[model samples]
Target chain A: MTTTLRTRQRFAKAGVLTGLVIGGLFAALPVLWMLSTSLKSNGEVFQNPPQLITESFSFDAYAEILGNGAQLRFFLNSYIVAFAVTVLTLLVAILAGYAFSRFTFPGQKTINAVIVSVQAVPPITLVIPYFGLVVALGLYNTYPGLILTHMVFTLPYAIIMITAYLNTLPKELDESVKVDGGTSWTALWRILVPISVPGLIAVGVYTFMISWNEYLFALTLTRTDDMRTVPIGIQLLMGQHSYEWNQMMAMSILGSIPVLVLFLLFQRRFIGGLTAGAVKA
Target chain B: MTSTTAPDTTAPTQEPVTPDRPRTTLTRRLSPFGYLSPTIVLIVVLMVIPIVMVISYSFRDNVIVQENSVFAGLANYTTVLTDPNFLAALKNTAIFITVSTVAHLILGLAFAMMLNTQLLGGVTKAIFRIVYILPWLFTIAVIAVIWRLLLDPSGVVNYVLQTLGLLQEGVNWLSDPGKALWAVTFVNIWSGYPFFMISLLAGLQGIPNDLYEAAAVDGANPVQRFLNVTLPQLRPVIISMAVLDLIWTSQQFALIWMLTGGGPLNVTEVLSTFTYKQAFSEYEFATASAAAVIVLLLTMVLAFFYVRLQKER
Candidate 1:
């Protein structure tokens, strides 16, 4: 009986191990396939067997596109816009989070509720008005316009996540800093900011991703190829006459690297951000 | 007594080391404002202004270039309600939300439960967790492109199914009206379930083990214990997750736009795509804005119930 029980346990363990292997392969397939296709020659993509790997790996796609100058401009544009949005969001969200979490003020609750209300509104709802406003402000084809529009989506998210995190921190540190002859501003810069670096980093990544991956506005607002983000640029690659599958796959993989690196670098805090976004307390 | 009194007077010669309170009433009141000012200004410019503009624009008549202001009171709203495209988008959005949310929840719960088993512990499990989460970090563009590749007529999926004799020929997964919506839902669920798994796992970890032991003592079966104990404990987490997923998936545009572009006669068009097509291709900003407003209202309704539920908990 004891032998049978032991054998049964072994069988279960083996089954689980096999399941994990299968799951891991399944999870990795699309990303791996992406990289594989990006390396393959254009003609090999539509083959019946589906070239999982090809002997004639070529950099022609990347080389040809990079030579065109459009891709380079798009990459530079995306970075500038994304970094600007990230920095701006972090600065604003950190201050607001500190205030909402620690301070007593008139209309505080109402302000927080308003922030919550912003999250409920679908971003698509604002696109038309934003188009009108962007044109009115004469920012129709500029970085500031795109950054400002992206902020509408990212700011509320940043505020909510940062505030939730800040509430978890003790208030005694702020009081102590104030008692030590520090002004509120000093307390904010010296005390709160350093302590909240993880949360700030998380918000920065979120904001950057929003700005970087934005499509509808990017596609509509930016007419010049130099102003297009990677998403829009890649979309344009799917033209009327023909679609370049290999080239599009290559661009998609390239476009994904920055955020993937950020996530890997700050996996722990990123998980916290994800949880905060999902399960608001 | 004399020594104590003398020391008290001597100590008073020194000023107090620190002050705990604000120096002035204004400073006291404005401290929070000082911290929140940047955020307040940003939100006002970015969020409030745009939303107000939307509301105002919905009242005007700007089906094309913004030339006229007829102040068509409720006409846009009436048209949006009565339009077949808008209604279809609404129905499709609702269906996508329901199907994706339910599928993710079930699969997520199963994955979490399985991972929580005592045998699947330590470094190996951590590796699995990390692998599972890799998909969530991918951009929507990447997801759309990769799924499009897999769902194409001569894609890897069809190739495998054919080899296995499950399919007689390659299926036009994206272009086919019957399959496009389900294909979108499938991609969404696949992209979403990992996050749910991790969340549910976290929630499960918080549940006490003694309840299971008590149920065992009562001779309750595994399924009975799960239904009676686990389900009730997980109710809040599940509801919150479902609400957030609904909003996120309902607003999904990039993936659908890239894959099918609401193709095969707009059968796959959700609100976001519908709005995009109307405003841009069709050149009807007022009607598009009306459709977007309906999406906001529906999502807000979902969000309201979730918020109230969270408050109750």
Candidate 2:
């Protein structure tokens, strides 16, 4: 009976190992294939018995993409817009989270409910009206237009996460500062903000990812290639040089690097804060 | 302590370190708004006004493309509701979201459960966890491009399947009318399941091992222990993830647009693509606004359930 039980346990372990390997391949194989194809020449892409590691591998695709002025502009635009969005979102979310966490006022419940519900407002719904709004305000094809619009989507989650983070902190921290002749604003900047770095980093990284990946608004609001971000730049790559699969793959890998780096660097805090915001709040 | 707090005396002047005690006056009551002004301004400008504009646009006749659009009471809504293509989009969205959400939940739970097993070392589990999350790190645009490469008729996917004797020949996965919707849905599942997996893994870690031991001591099998303890413990997480997935998957536009362009006879034209085409490609802003509103209402319904689920938890 002991031998039988041990055998069964071994079989179960083997089954699980098999499942993990298959699932890992399912998830990671395409990503590896993308990296491989990015290194290969365009002609090597459709080679019979498609290669995961091409014999003719080179950095020529990455060089072509990086050297091209138009493609480089996409990277620059994405960085500027993503960084700006992250900063602006953290600023606004910190203040709003302070309000929600520390104070009571009329219509607080209503305001909180509205903010939570704001996440549901479909972007397609807003895109039409924003087309008219952006053009009317003379902000079309501009950085501020994208930054402001992206904030609406990012702010709700940030405020929710940051508020939850702040609620765990004692109100006496603020109170003692007030007693020491520090204003609410001073206490916020000096004490609360410093301690909330981990939460803020999580929100900041998620915000950057959203703005970096945004496509519909970028497509609709911007007309010129000068203002287009990476996602749209990829689309244009498909159009401008039909089936330049190597360059397209290279641009995608380059486009994904920032968010990928951020996630790897802050994987634990990111997931913790994300689950709290997304699952809890 | 700076002089900044000297002039800010209120009820807190007497007892400075009180724990959010009731304000003695109205002037003192509205203080938090100082910090909240930026958020309120953004909410009003970005959310409140645009939503109002979209609703009003739905009532008007081709507003964005034309200078003067008249208020046509419920006319655009009627047109969208009656149009066969609109209906087709709605039907496809239902299938896409339903299948994608179910698959995500199942795959998420299975991988999460397996990773939660004590059979593996922490290093092994951590490696698998990162591997599982790999698909989710790429942007949807990159995901679209990668899949397009793989699903090409002569792509690696066909080569493997053909070698395994599973297919007689290569199939055009994206362009084929019979397969486009499924192809797009599969990509979404790939990119989306990790989120559910992460959440469920957290939920699994939260379940105590004592419960499993107790069930085993009672002669309960592995399946019985899972059904009895694991599923009930996880029901809340599953519901929340499913509702959120429905909203996210329903709003997917970039993936479909990039992969198939809702093409091959509109087989994969989900609501987002349908609405986008009406507004941009066809320049029928009126009907698109109406369709957009419908999509909004549908998402609100899902989100309402989500907020309520959070409250319940």
Task: Tell me the TM-score of each prediction against the true structure.
Answer: 0.92, 0.96
Q: What's the CA error at residue B228 for candidate 2, in Å? A: 0.6
For model 2, residues A1-281, the per-residue Cα lDDT tens digits are 99998999899999999999999999999999999999999999999978777888899999999999999999999999999999999998998898889787788999999998898888999999998899999999999999889898899999999999999998888878877876677778899999999889999999999999999999999999999999999989988998899999999999999989999999999988887776677
The DockQ values of the predictions, listed in order, are 0.46, 0.67
- The 10-residue segment of model 1 chain B with minimum total lDDT is B4-13
Native contact fraction of candidate 2? 0.71
User: TM-score of the A chain in candidate 2?
Assistant: 0.98
Q: How far off is residue A183 in model 1, in Å?
A: 1.0
lDDT of 1 by residue, B1-313 (tens): 1211111111111234345433444454566777777777877877778777777667767743757667878888898899898788888888888999999898788777766767767877877778777677777777888888888899888999999999999999888889889898888887878888878888888789999899989999879999988999888999888887888788888888988888767788888998888888888888777777777788888889878888888
Candidate 1 per-residue lDDT, tens place, A1-281, comes to 99997998888888877876776676778878888888888888878788788877887666656676777787889999899989888877877887787666789989988888777778788788778878888999899999888787788889888888788887666666666766555666788788888888888887888888888788777778778888887777766228677887888777888988887888778777877676674
User: Candidate 2: where are CA atoms >4 Å away?
Assistant: A1-4, B1-27
**Model 1 regions more than 4 Å off:** A65-68, B1-23, B217-221
Winner by TM-score: 2
Fnat scores for every prediction: 0.57, 0.71
